[model samples]
Target: MDIDARTLRTFREVTLTGSFTQAARRLGYSQSSVTAQMRALERQVGEPVFERLPNGVRLTHSGIVLRDYARQILTLVGEMETALRRPAANPPRLTVGIVPALAYGQQLARVTHIGRRLLSGVQLALRIMGTAEVHDAFKAGAIDGALVLTVVDADDPADLLGEQQYADRSDDLTEVRLQEVEFVPVTGVGRRPGGHGRQVVIADPDCPSQRWLPEFLRLRCDSPPEIHELGSMAGVRAATQSGLGCAMLPTALAADHEEAGGLRPLPGVPRMRWNASLILGRHDTRPAVDRQNLTETLRQATALGRAARPAVPAAEVLGGAGLGGEVLGGGATALDPDTSIAS
Candidate 1:
C-alpha cells in the first residue's frame, strides 16, 4: 500500500499515545479528523489497524508490523534531509547506540562535549536501546558504534566481536571505561524500622542487576522479599519513595533522591559495582581525522564522569578480555595518560 507521510505520522502519533483524542490534541487536529485519517490509512492498507480495549486503543498485529516499516522509512527520510543540508566540509555522520540506563546527566555531558569539539559539523546520532539491542544493532551495521554495559563473560565469542573489556568488552572496537558506579539498596526516608518486610523493586529481568540480584538476595535474606519488576530507575525510585518497597539503585540515583527527601539508603547493604564502556566497530570506514576527534571527545566525556564524587577505579574500567578469551586486538595500545584516569 502507498501510505503517505502524513498518514504514517498520524499512525505513529496514535500508536505512541494510544488515544486518538490525545494524538489529535498533540497534532492540533479535531478528534474526528484524526479518526478519519486513521480510517483512511486503514482502508489503503486493507486491514484493521487498531482495536479499542477497556484500557485504551491498541495496535492490531497488522499495525504492529507496519509500525516497524514506518519507523525505517521516517529514519531514511530524516537522513536524506540531513545529508542535503550538511556542509561539504563536515565530517561523516557517526551513529552511536546507547543503553536506556546511560541516558542521564554524565552521558549527556559526554554527548555535549562531542558535539562542541570533535563532532562539530558531524552528525552524532545517539540511539537509546537495551544492551542486547545495542549489540544486535552494532552487528547488523545499523549503528557505527555504541556505549553499553558488558554482561557476558569477557572470553565469549560475542564479546570479542567488537572491543574487549572485563566488565564492558567488545572485539574490534575502541573501548573507553566511563565510570564504575555502585548500586545500593534504598528506602523512603523516615520509614518504619521493619525493613525486612519491605518489597524490593528491580529493573526488568533483562538488566544486569536483576540477573545478579536474586542470587545476592537469596544468600543474604532469610526468605524471598516481595519483588516488583519495573521498567526504569525512575519508576523504582518513585515506588520506593512512596513507601512501596526498597529498591536497589545506583549510588548516583540514590543520592539525588535522598537529597530531595524522596529516599534513603538502607543501612548495611553491600554496594555492587557496574561499569559503562564505549564500543566502535573496527571495520567502520569513517575518516581517520574524524575517528581521532571523536575519540578525544569521548575521553573528555568519560573524564567528566570520573570527576564526579566517589572516584571510580581505572583498573575496573578495562578494554580487554576477562577470564574468558575475548581478545581486544593483536597490538592495541593502552588509553593515553591525558585521557584516562589512573587506576
Candidate 2:
C-alpha cells in the first residue's frame, strides 16, 4: 500500500488533538476533510485507527503503533530532505523572517555579517512580521527561518532552534528568553501632565510585552488607565512621543529621546526585560555547510551584542528596574556602540 506524507501528517495531527474537529482547526482543514483523510489512512493500514466516542476520540492499538512509526518516518524523511537539499556548486538563498523590533537591533548586523563572511554567495531575504505571522509563514514554507519571541508552552522542542528560558509566564503563553531586552516607559518632552489623561500605548495586543503590560499595570497602579494598542512598536513610540500617551520603549531605541529629555519612565515603574529567540522552520532546505555558517554567524553576533551592553539591573531588567532610577539599555542606543565599534 502506498502511504503519502499528507496522510501521515493528518494521522499525527488527529492523534495529537484526539479530536478531528480540533485537528482540523489546527491544520486549517474542515472536520469532514480531516475525517475523510483519517478514514483513507485507516483503509490503507487495514485497521481502524481511531474509535469515536461521544466525549471525543481515542487511538486504537494499531493507531498507537502507527503513530510511533509515523513519527519516526516523518523525522527520517525530514532529515533525508535536509541532506538531499544541501547546495552543491551554487550557494543557496536563505529567507529569514524577523519582527520589526528584532530587525532593528544587533540581529540585522549579525545576519548581514553572516551573509558576507560565512554565507558568501548565499542571498539573504528578510521579511518583517509578527511572531505569529512568522511561525505561520515558516510552516507554510514561505520563509526558511525567523527570529521571534514565542511562548514555550506548546512549542515542540524539535521545532526550536536553540536554548530556551522563561521570560514571563502568562495565562496563554510562557514568554521565553531569546535575547535580553531593556524596556523603558517614555512620554513626549515638555508635555504637560494630565493633558490627555494617562495613555498607555502597546504594540499588538498579542505581543508578549503587551500581554504582560496589563498585568504589570495592575500590579503598579490601582486605577485603570486608558490603553492604546498599535500594530507596531514604532507606532506606539511615535504615538507616545506625540504626547498622545506613554509607551514602554526599548532602552536602546529610546536613548536619543532620553538624552534629549523627551522621554522618561514613570516614577516607580521598573525597567522591563524580555527574551528574543532565533526560530527556523524544521524544513529549511539550506545545505548543511550553509546552515552551520549561518547559525555560527548569528550565535557570534548575539554573543557580541550581549557582551557589549551593560546588564540592565535585574529589577529594571523586566519585572521592575528598581526604585533607584538606574538607566538600563534596550533600544537603538545599545546597538549604536556596536555599529561604531565595528566601523
Candidate 3:
C-alpha cells in the first residue's frame, strides 16, 4: 500500500502503546492527528489496522502483520534521510607540505594522527620537503598547506622569515604558530672527533642546521668534522646510534637514542629553538574544498594554546578537545582571515 513514513511511525507507536491518546502524547502529535493517520493507514490497506476495545485497543490479525512491515519501511526511510543529510563522503584532496625534520619528529606523528581524525572524509597527502622547498611549493600551488619550522631568535630576526619569503605576501597567506621545538646535537655514545662521530649527520640541503652547524662545529671542536647528509630521519638516527656521525635532531628523537644509551648530547653545544607554524592559503584563494572541516582540523591540531597574534576570525567556536566522539565535528582555525605579516 502507499503508506508514508510518518503514517507508518504513528501506526507503530499506536501499536506500541495500544492507546491512540498515549501514542499521540509520546509522538508529540494531537490525538486528532493520530486518528487521521490511522484512518489513512487503514484506508490504504483496505482493512482496520487496530481493533478497538472498551479499555483502549488491540491489533487486528492484519494489524499485527502490518506492524512488521511498517517498522521495516520506517527504518528504510530513516536510513535514506540520514544518507541525504550528511556531507559528501569525500572532498578535494588536502596536500600538506612538511620538512623532513618535523615529519620525522614525535610531535608530527601525533599531529598527523589527529589531523586525519579532524579532516575525516578528505584525502590527505604529505609532501616531505626541506625548509626552503616548502616556500616554492606553496607559490607554485603544488601544496594546499604546510607546516614550516621557523628559528625564533631575537638577535637574528631573519630567522623568523628565513627561506619562507611569503611573509611579504600577507594577503596570500597566514601562519598559526604552534609550540616551540628544541633541537640538540647528538652523537653515538663514547665517540669523539676524527672518528665515526667526527662526521656530522644532517638532512640534505635546505635544513637550517645545514647552514649553521659547520660554523658552530668549527668553533666548538679542535678541528671541525666533515659533513655527511642523510635523507631520512630513521637513517640519521640509525647512523648516529651506530657511531656513523653526530646528528642534530629534535630533542624527542634525540632523547629516545639517549635513553637507550646509544647516543649522548655533544658537550657544550647549545640547543636550537624553532617554532612550528602552520601555513594556510588565505582569503578567497584558500584551496580547501571544505572550509568547515579544514577549520576543525586546524583547531584540533593546535589545541595547545591561542595564537600570539590575531585569533581565528568569523567562525563557530569549536574548542580543541582533540578528536572526541564526534570525528567530523566542525570548528574554526586560529588563522586570522585578514592577517598582516608584521603581526
Cα deviation at 278, candidate 2, in Å, is 0.8
lDDT of 3 by residue, 1-343 (tens): 6777778777877875679998786566999999998998889999887889997889999999998787567545544553455576565578888777766755455566766655555667778787777656878988887776655431232434345454465456655555555566677886754353257887745666444455455433436667777877777888888877777777766776789898886653445545666667655353322443343344345443222322121111122332112222123222232321111
Candidate 2: stretches off by over 4 Å:
1-91, 105-110, 150-178, 194-197, 222-224, 283-285, 300-343
- For all predictions, the C-alpha RMSD in Å is 21.7, 14.9, 19.9
For the record, the alpha-carbon RMSD of candidate 3 to the native fold, in angstroms, is 19.9
Models sorted by TM-score, best on top:
3, 1, 2
Highest TM-score scorer? 3
Lowest lDDT block of 10, candidate 3: 310-319
Ranking by lDDT: 3, 1, 2
Estimate the overall C-alpha local distance difference test score of candidate 3: 0.61
**Number of the top lDDT candidate:** 3
Tens digits of per-residue lDDT for model 1, 1-343:
7888777777877886789997786566899999999999889889898998876699999999998888667545544544566477755668877655555555666676655544556778777666556666876888987766544334353443223332253444545444455555677886566553346776645456444444344434435666887766677778888887676676666776788888876653434555566677656677643554454466455545432333222223232233122222322222232321111
- Report, for all candidates in order, the number of backbone clashes: 13, 21, 0
For residue 228, give model 2's deviation from the true position in Å: 2.7
The worst-scoring run of ten residues by lDDT in candidate 2 lies at: 334-343
Q: Provide the TM-score for each candidate, comma-separated.
A: 0.53, 0.53, 0.55
- TM-score of model number 2: 0.53
Q: What do the candidate models score in CA lDDT, each in turn?
A: 0.60, 0.59, 0.61
